[model samples]
Target: MKQRLSLIIGIFIVMALSNAIVPVLPEYASEMPALQGIIFSAYFFGAFVMVIPAGVLGDRYGRAPFITAGLLLTLLSGGIILLAANPYAITFARIVEGIGAGLFVSCALSWVNMQPDHTRLSGLYFAGLNAGLIAGLMGTGILNSHFGQNSGVMLFTGLAVIPLLLSFFIRDTTGVLTNVLPPVHAIGWRNKWLYFSSFILVGISGVLVSLYPEFTDESPFILGLLFAAMNGATICASLIAPNISLQPIQTIRLASALVGIAVLLSFIAPAYGGIGGVFVLFMVIGGSIGFVFVSQMNYLAVSEKLQGTAIGLLTAASYGGMAMLPFFSGLLTEVFSYGAAFLVNGILCLLVTVTIARCRCALPE
Candidate 1:
């Protein structure tokens, strides 16, 4: 019981540290677009680079070691960001932070699902993750606005230390789930259709995650505050999500639609003046963000075998799209304007919403 409590604390710390960049990217990127984009990559590269290894290692050995190492990496990354000046420093810091995020999530979820009260534990995990994200973004933005960028980075560094403190409690788990367990059938290479369908919906969410840095630049303090607003709405939506009753595909389709509409309202009309439009945009973005994640997580939990490995794969797909899209979005902004970029991206999301709906009806239940 004590072990689980500590583990939860560790996971929350990891999330907060991992997301510290969300509100601070604008400050870090001041004249450095590459670093801003690199912030996304820092996380992606770490997660993507380590996904396969973490999976193989967690399944073959145990999930705890990876989780421990990852936490420390987060601490290292936080330290770098706190002193960051150039794009290289920022990107490198993200790389370390990403390493920790990748390890913690893949293995931590694996460990939790093995617990006696798995469903409740899963809920707690999601709750903690969302809550931490809000804290890191919100806290950093306020700190950056009042203190300076270094202070914002230091805030993450401080949070990063919290997870490492949990190392003492995570001694062993009695091997709840193990690699020796027989594997279940996976979608495999033939499931490109499933991946392609899922990928676009991820992009719909991904664009917004990437856009946050730019939005924060508009108002550093508000950027963090807006992120908290978005997460708050998402937590509410997820709470009521079960009652809404739609299968995985249907839920994702719905979320895609909401996101598309939100993007249009935010980018096209910029309704209710500048600040209000951004605020509303944040509201819309938050409400729809968790839909795809929850939907996909449900699918993975039920459909995939070697759950840890499968979750890693899911993270890869989700973050992979997130990492690449921002650079493209940046390029688009360079070519035209942020407003135009948002409109085009929103259109892309709308198109995917249609594709997913059409595919859902065609696929067997």
Candidate 2:
């Protein structure tokens, strides 16, 4: 139980550190508004680059060293951001943070999967992730509003120290495995399909994270509250996931429908009911994505040998979507409007969900 708690807390800290600057990032790039998306994507781009290798290596060696090394890198990245004066420097710092995130998340997930009660633990794991995001967004917004950007970055830097300290206690479990695990290619096509579908679901979250602040001109406090509400909903959904009795595919389909509805409502809500409507829809979307994420994690955990690789690939795909989709969504926003971009992406999500559901029927049981 102590180990589980520590791991959960470590995961929470990593996620919080990753998202700490999200609310303030737009303002940070106000001087170079045209590059906001690119700047925002640098972190995920770094994660996408490193996740696969981290996964493979973590499986071969042990997760503890990687987790610890990742946290150190995150610390370094935070220090860089705290001192960075130029956009280029900040972007580079974000990439370093992303690589650290990839290493930490991939190894942490694999560590949790090796535990006995992974299904229940998976829920807690995701809850910690969302809760961290909530803390980062809310805390950063409030702090930056009062103490300024440097202070906010410093707060994040301070928070990183706790996890870096705790990571040392995480057990290296590679010694317990009796047989040699197969290569990455051993992960079957069915799992790949599931990963792809989950990736699309995650893209909705990326879009929300990257662009939601720009959707409104409200105060930072209000924006923080809105994002906090959404992430709070996600935490609630994750906590409830263990009790859900639906099969994986059914859960995925339901989550897909909910996310599509939320997106459409997001477009309609602001125009009609204003921020309140959008807030409610964002909560729904967050909950739906939570369900999708936990379901995918549970599905991947079924294969003991490939659990690390499967999760690594899934994480990579997720960050890849985060990196690519939101950057284009930003471009779409420039060409059209936020509403149009949301609508288009929402429709694309629905289409991908339907196609994946159809493909599932053809897979060997």
The per-candidate count of clashes, in order, stands at 0, 0
Q: Could you give candidate 2's per-residue lDDT for residues 1-365 as a string of tens digits?
A: 55676568767777777777676667668867667656667888889988887877788777789988888898899899888887788899989999998898888888877776777898899999888888777777678779877666787688778778877777876433324664666564656666766677788777876677667667767777877888888899988987875456777777887888788778767778898888888899888888877777776665446556767888988887777777688889999998888888888678766766653422123
What lDDT does model 1 reach? 0.65
Every candidate's CA RMSD: 4.2, 3.0
lDDT of 1 by residue, 1-365 (tens): 65576567776777677666776666667877665766756777887777655765676687878877888887887777767777688788777777778887777776665555554565556667778777666776667679876675676577656667766567545543564642423433433334554555455555666676564455555655665777777666555554443466676667777777787777644435576677777677666755555555555555554657666666666667666666677778889888876787777667666665543323225
Predictions in order: lDDT: 0.65, 0.77
| Model 2, residue 179: C-alpha shift (Å) | 10
lDDT of 1 at 277: 74
TM-score, one value per model:
0.79, 0.89
List the candidate 2 regions with Cα displacement exceeding 4 Å. 23-30, 174-182, 185-188, 336-339, 358-365
